[model samples]
Target chain A: MVNSWLELGAQKKDTPVKHNYSIFRRNCLMGIVLAVLLMSGPQRSWGQSEKPSIDFFSGFEVGLYDFYFYQKYNVVFNLTPGFKWNMGNHWQLAGQARLTVINQLSNDVRRFYPSMLVLSKELKAGPVYLKGSVGAFSNSRYGFDLKAFLPVTPWLAFEAQAGLTGLLTMAGGWGMSPMGRFTGTVGGDIYLSRWNTQLRGVVGKYVYTDWGFQAEAMRHFNHATVGLYAKWNNIAGQLGQEGVSLTQSLAKGMDGGFKVTIMLPPYKRTHRTVNFRPASHYSLTYLVRGMAQYRDANQLYYTDPEENMRDGWFSRDLLKWGSHTMEPDFIYKGKEETE
Target chain B: MKRIKISYILLAAMVLLPSLSHAQQYNGTSGFLHIPSAEMSHEGDARMGVHYLNKALLPDTGFLFQGEKYNTYDFYLGITPFEWIELSFTSTRRKDTRAVTGEVGFWRKDRYASIKIRPLREGRYHPAVAIGFNDVGTTAFNKERTDVQLYFTNIYVAATKHFGFGGNELGVNLAYRHYFRNYNDKWSGLVGGLSFRPAFFPQGRAIVEYMGNEFLIGADALLWQHVLIQASLIDFKYLNLGLCLQLNMLGKKYVVAER
Candidate 1:
């Protein structure tokens, strides 16, 4: 079946029939151009157009258990790799992928990992440059996110966000089914020099088969950020269980952790510039934290271990970076050996 | 002969008192009343009441009232212009037995208002549904927020028989209530209850109610045609057993010919 499908695709590509290869190729080229315009337009206009940009961040935390079964403190870790491109003016397109790992100390649980992909659009709308992400996380279970920022001053600004996250049935274990969760938060950011600091408190609710309250606080510092979150889930009622009867089933708990991120430059030319640089951007970040989780046994247990680690380092010089250069000047000038 | 006439008049007034007080003009009007239970050690427990109808009151306007229990007394009033809709405002005050540990009295009071509606009007056995939103203001908390507001909806079906004390009428009701928003978040449970009311009596009428997992019973009586009295006893299931009283403004009158 796979071979047949591939043969059909290849035949379509070779055929010059109407609505075939030419149209597909045109659409693909258009998509690539649009993506390039959106990702590079802002960075070319912003300051530091010449110097390559890189961001680095990381953090750590301690977890504690306060329940009936194995009660102890543990550790966790996380890491992220990100890239930012100036689209033009004060606008930019940034992309990041986060990898998280969790380890339980007492129970000897080896690894629980999740990943997030973020595509953010940032623009200066008045005094503050608003930033927001329109992306998906965890295999696209979560929906979209909308965020806004208003600068009280150049150094400080107020920010707010509304997000809908999907809780997959597999992720919720036995207690909760797959459902969408709504979250809203309002907070402020204080930029101290190159180091941008943010503090935000959030309140929201999860509406699944069962509905419950959700709250969280996050502090982001430049490339590194830390977050503390708590959820009070009530799933038993939807399963036809009475509230009083389910009160002893399990207790809600909190999860908190620190995360770091490294920003890498683009692999291609910074823009449609005449000069072609032979170096690619790269980043590496690490994070560690602890979580207090509640199990169905009505016990609070602390599970903490090295949570996440990520590394992304690359060099373009060996790959003849400018061989496929697109700019007219770069094509005409040819590649030069940097001694 | 004059003395006899005066005695007869007095007797007539006494006989007409209860009907005159309980003769409500509207079908779906709600009011607030304090509940006093004789069976419980604590006598004064107050609650708010709301009702709505389509056949009574104005064509479409309804009325509501709220009241609190002070020791053994309850005060309430209501108005409804529409038969299908009603609104009620209520205030309740009671001593907090659990707050005896502090120097200040554990007396707490709450004020709230609610609106209700009934959809089916003409059936002998009709299902009545109502949804209400309430803002609870309590004296115990210094800063009041809308965090504790309550959303409640219920559906009930009732059947009436035309044979009470004098072949008048009697109604039996069964209802299920789902509390949501804030109240259900704290107290999660399904409430099913039953109510019974007599059509008429020599003077007025009476109502008996039962609810909760444990058998809880409550009763209310109308007197002097305008005044109502009620009480109840609650069991282990957090059901309230209480009594209540209402004063009627309109009473029935009968004509007699002199011999």
Candidate 2:
């Protein structure tokens, strides 16, 4: 009699499962609607001038373990399509919409995070670039981030960022009690023609961290860029006082990963490429390198030929000094060389 | 309501004034992307151009929503003094809101000069190269807004190549621009565009531009011998329209077919 009573109770408990199904259906529908709307524009070739263009991006990443959830072996899938708009010579706006799906292989659990929207504004002035955005992350966290990049010299640039976010607990009993937090990053980029390195110090709530340091290096190829990053968190390991393993702090933790990005062509012209030039047009090796490559010095060293001619004034005579006889008469053609 | 009435009145005047001129010449070298072109206007030709940009279409909510009506008006007087050089003076007025405060009471007016120079001609394989300075003229104010410097300035250099295949012609232009200002002063970005005329519409042409950060789609059509109409959708939100009047300030010439 008791076993029959329990069976009846189990059948009565189907309402919650039905409710969860309804929520999942709603989210899927929303994603489909957004995808359709973004892809509905005219099919003509675009991004040819000072206007806005649309592009789509997707990424898949596998993590050995989730630092925050303490889950072993998880995979993340991201789909993002964005519109980039140029306001003027100095300003740009980008609307980024992203959907993320996280799957944990160990427990055979799958979770779908809500779509996120981010509007980022970028401004450039002289040697400084500023980027700020207000958006929600796929983790059901809403936030704003402000970042600035300042080029102290041609080969070195400093970057700083600060963000504020409010987290919401979700499936798997993770992120319980959802609290507000602040995060900051300070970094610098070292650039070479084909390679770049970033060293950053991060402090905030990312997989439970009071602070962390990261070093990343990327190599650029003709059509793709490959990068690897290593991170060390919380120099001192700290455990949560009252929480499960999922909420336990991952301080003093270490992790590393590799990423590859492929660029599609009919590429847009933007500062992302030009800013990599080395500072000081008078670098001795740059000229020799240009000559060795049989590249046009005008095209390689300057944005405009007129500017190239003017800049060559500095290194031209230097190049001629060793090439031709450095006679006093040849050197004193004008006193402006010394003045 | 009063502001809307004044806008209508101004637009009507702009459309009417172009009809007063009786020059039987339309300009073939007048089209530009969002920025001025490296190509000059017809030699010794002068024109008055007006442009209106309305950035008030997005809803007040989403990430792309621009809260208030942000509108701009640009009036340009452009002249081609030499076969390879063009000069333009522009008066621009903008009405926007304070970034932090939502009040729509902010307004600014700036007068600037634009200069373009074409140094190389198109050859069988080599493209035509042109260089230009955008918004070069400004009265001395703060160092940040100074426009006279060349390095880290608003300079754009472009190279255009024309390709003809089976009677269809397409012009591809690639440009590099560097701007010197706070936060935007250090680096340069690449932007390019394609210009072509449709077979069905011989009198009209379309320009598609990727200005590094955004994309612009627009069309320019000749309404009359001396009148040209220009319209564009900026970022798929604002509808920008323009009316240009060409006049023979110094010599007589008619629009020539683009080569």
The Cα error of candidate 1 at residue B77, in Å, is: 60
lDDT of 2 by residue, B151-251 (tens): 21267788887776544457787888776553343235887778765444445556677766667666666555567676555554445677777655333
- lDDT tens readout by residue for model 1, A1-339: 101222234444655555444544554454355445445535422442223343222232223322211222244443434444434332333333333465343333223322333444444434443344433333323334445656575455566655544322122121111213455555554444322223333333322223344343332222223233344445422323555444443332322222333222232223333333322212221111112121221111101011111110101121111111111111212334210
Q: How well does candidate 1 score on lDDT at residue A318?
A: 14
Model 2 chain B: ten consecutive residues of lowest lDDT: B19-28
| Tens-digit lDDT track of model 2 for A16-65 | 65654564465445444533533342322122123333323333333322
Model 1: fraction of native contacts: 0.00
Candidate 2: global Cα-lDDT? 0.44
Best by TM-score: 2
> lDDT by residue for model 1 over B65-147, one digit each (tens)?
12222231112223221345443344333233333344322134333333345554434344334332332122122124456
By TM-score, how accurate is candidate 2? 0.34
Backbone collisions counted per model: 66, 32
- What is each candidate's fraction of native interface contacts (fnat)? 0.00, 0.00
Chain B TM-score for all candidates, comma-separated: 0.46, 0.70
